[model samples]
Target: MIVADKKPIEEIIDEIKRHTKILILGCNECVTVCESGGKKEVEILASALRMYFTNNQQEMLIDEHTLERQCDHEYLEEIRDRIDQYDAVLSLACGVGVQFMAEKYHATPVYPGVNTCFLGATEQRGLWTERCQACGKCILASTGGICPVSRCAKRILNGPCGGSTNGKCELSKDLDCAWQLIIDRLKALGRLDDYETVYPIKDWSTDRAGGPRKVIREDVQV
Candidate 1:
């Protein structure tokens, strides 16, 4: 899932302070699981902002709403009727969701309430770690399910860099060497022989070098 972290309240206040009527929109998807931009987070942020404004002798209209998803067109339509009533919208979704909401309501200003982190997994409660970089090409099939592209400090493809020591990355002792993990995994699977076969240089064109990407699946098109 996409992981995100909350922005500082002072920064948020600075952004929407000029607007009298503000809408704090939440998302019920990835941000919800990450506890950054969910319904609960939205309510908490709204309350904090309300209190801040009240104490400052400012009268602000800050309303809260949570959408099933801000990235989907169907879900975003739910707010179309009431969108115009607000001076601005503070979207507590991923960066994608914030952009989609802004595009859907071009006239209304959309501000991001959270900082989009990366494609990651929840290691445990309150702990999320990066897993994939979405390079547009998956190499997990040959790499024993360990992703060096995302895990390696230098993004090495072939083997562990000399910087690794005792199964830990040179960058940090807590960080496991991506290549070491791959070799261990392959050994366990009895696929150590596959390691001898060197992988070819990855095609750079398939990644972000091409710029904003889109997929056109004819079968799934309406």
Candidate 2:
């Protein structure tokens, strides 16, 4: 899941300072699970904005709506008629969803309400941890399911650098040493020999430096 957090109210207020008519758009997708942007959050923010405007004696019109997904054209189409009524849109979705909305509605200014953090998973109640960096290339098959690119402090392909101490990262004692964890996991599965194998240097040019990446399958294409 993609994790994000809401921007500060002060910052959000500043973005729409000049707009009297605003639409607070929320997404019932990834942001909802992370508790950053959702229907309930949209209402709370809209109410807060109204209070702020009222306190300042400014006449403001704030409307709130949550789409099943802002990134999907079908979901975004649902707001086509109503969105034009607002002077600006504040999207409470991930960065991708915000861009999608902006592209679909070219006339209105779109503002991001949440900061996209990372591709992560919920570890427990109230805790989320990053699991992938989306490097565009995956090597988990050889690494015992541990992602060194994101988990390792240095992102070493073959490592627990010399700085690692007592199964903890040198950068922070609280951080579990990624390579140590990999070794332990592989050992538990009787695959400790995998650690001795060397991995080639990552070719970043093939990953992201070339340009935007895409995957097409004739079977899946319409």
Candidate 3:
């Protein structure tokens, strides 16, 4: 999931402070799962902004709405009629949603309300950790499902670096060594031989290092 953390209220207030009319937009997707942006968050932010304006006698009009998703055109179109009602929008969705909304509505200023963190999973309540980097090349099959690119401190593909000690990462005592985990998993699966087979240098072209990338299936074209 795309994990995110809410921006400080002070920074948010600073951005929309000049606008008398504003909209607090939220998404019911990843941000919602992370408790960063959702209908509930939207209401809370809206109320806070309203209270700020009221207390200061700033004469501001703050409205809010949450879409099923902000990344899709069909869902974003739902707000087309009401888009012009606000001067600017404070988007609580991930960066993708904010950019897409700005692209769809060129007239309005779309501001990010949260800091897009990473592709990760919730380890427990109020705790999330990075899982994948979306490098465009997946080698989970050989690595026993552990991701070397993300979990590994140096993004090593071959195996644990010399820095690995006692199954923990050299970077931090709390961090587990990705290659060590891979070796252990492979051993448990009786596929320890996969460890001896060295993987070739990763193809950078498949990663974001190549540039903004896209995938298309002609068979699915509309």
Candidate 4:
């Protein structure tokens, strides 16, 4: 899932302070699951902003809405008729959703209301850990399903670096050595021989090195 963290209220206020009317838009997807930007969060932020404006004798019109998703055109179209009512939109979706909304609306200013963190898993309530960098390649099959690109401190593919000691990352004692986890996983799976195999240099073009990326599926086209 795409995990995100709420932006500080002060920074958010600073951005939209000049606007008399604003829309606090939320997403019901990943950001909601992560508890960063959902219906509840939108209400909280809107109320806080309203309080700030009211306390300072500023007349501000702040409204809130949550879409099934901000990334899709269908869900975004739900607000088409009412969109022009606001001076600007404070999108509580991920960075991708904010950009998509801006691109679609074009005329309105769209501001991100949260910091896009990473593609991660929910370890527990209120806790998320990075799992994938979206490097456009899958090395998990060779590494017993552990992702080195995201979990490893140095992103070492071959094996653990000399810096790691006692299965802990050199960067921090609390951090587990990703490669060590891989080795243990492989050992448990009775595939320890796979560790001896060397992986070639990763192709950088498949990653963000080539700028924006896209995938097409003609089968699902309109």
Candidate 5:
């Protein structure tokens, strides 16, 4: 899932201080699971903003709403009637959701309420770690399910860099070497022989170098 964290309250306040009427929009998807921009978080932020305005002797109209998803056109259409009433909108979704919402509601300015992190997984409660970079090219088959692209500090493709020591990355002792994990998993699967095969230089054109991407599945398209 996409992981994100809330922006500083002071920064958020500064963005909307000029706007008397604002909408605090939350997403019920990724940000919800990450505890950054969910319904609960939106309510808290709305209350805080209201309190801040009240204490400062300022008049502000703050309202909260959570969409099933901000990225989907169908979900975003739910607010089509009410969106224009606000001076501005603060979206508590990933960067994608914010941009998509802004595009959908072109008349209203959309602000990001959280900082989008990366494609990651939840390790434990309150702990999320990067898992994939979405490079467009997948190589997990030869690596025994361990992603060297995202897990490796240096993003090495073939083998462990010399910086690793005792199965730990030199960047940090607590961080496991991506190559080490790959080798161990491969050994357990009796696919150690796969390691001997040299992987050619990756063609990065399929990645971000190619710019924004989209998947078009003709089979699923209506």
Candidate 6:
């Protein structure tokens, strides 16, 4: 899922200060799973903003809403008529959702309330970790399902870098050595011999660095 974190309250306040009436829009999708931008979070932020404005003696109208997904045009269309009631929109979804809202509602200014972090998964409650860099070339089959491209501190294609110590990453003791995890997983699967095969340097050309990627499906095209 796309992971993100709320921006500093001060920064968010500064962005929408010019608008007296604002909409705090949240997403019920990815951001909800990551605990960054969801219905509950939206209310918390809205209440905090109201308190801040009240303490500052600033008169502002703040309203909150959560969509099933802000990135989907169909979901955003539902708010088309209602959006005009507000002077600005503070979107609590990921960066993609913010942009989608902006494109759909060209008249209203849409500001991001969170910093898009990464495409990741929950390592544990309160602990979200990146597992895929979306490098465009998937190699999980060769690495015992461990993604060194993202999990590794250095993103080494073939490694257990000398910096790794006792199965812990050199960059941080709190981080598990990705290569070590791969080795252990491979061992459990009786595929330790797979490690003997070296993976070539990644061909980033297939990834975003090359150009915008595209997918065309003749059957899906109407």
The predicted structure with the larger TM-score, 1 or 2, is 1
Q: Is candidate 2 or candidate 5 better by TM-score?
A: 5
Model 1 per-residue lDDT tens digits across residues 34-149: 99999999999999999999999999999999999999999999999999999999999999999999899999999999999999999999999999998889999999999999
Q: What TM-score, to 2 decimals, does candidate 1 have? A: 0.99
Candidate 3 TM-score to native: 0.98
Candidate 5, residues 1-222, lDDT tens digits: the string is: 999998999999998899999999999999999999999999999999999999999999999999999999999999999998999999999999999999988889999999999999999989999999999999999899999999998998988989989999999999999999999999999999999898899988889999988888999999
lDDT of 6: 0.93
**Tens digit of lDDT per residue, candidate 2, span 134-214?**
888898988899999889979999998998999999889899998998999999989999889999988776466768887
Query: On residues 1-222, what C-alpha lDDT tens digit does candidate 3 reach at each position?
Result: 999999999999999998989989999999999999999999999999899889999999999899999999999999999989999999999999999999999999999999999999999989999999999989898899999999998999997899999999988999999999999999999999999999999897989889999998999999
Candidate 5 residue pairs in clash (backbone atoms < 3 Å)? none
Candidate 3 vs candidate 4, TM-score winner = 4
* lDDT tens readout by residue for model 6, 109-129: 999999999999897999888
Order of candidate numbers by lDDT, starting with the best: 1, 4, 5, 3, 6, 2
Q: What is the TM-score of each candidate against the true structure?
A: 0.99, 0.96, 0.98, 0.99, 0.98, 0.95
> How many residue pairs clash in model 2?
0
Q: Which ten residues in a row have the lowest lDDT in candidate 5?
A: 205-214
lDDT of each: 0.96, 0.92, 0.95, 0.95, 0.95, 0.93
Q: Compared to the true structure, candidate 2 yields what TM-score?
A: 0.96
Off by over 4 Å in 6: none
- RMSD in angstroms between candidate 6 and the native structure over all alpha carbons: 1.3
Count the clashes in each prediction: 0, 0, 0, 0, 0, 0
Clashing pairs in 2: none
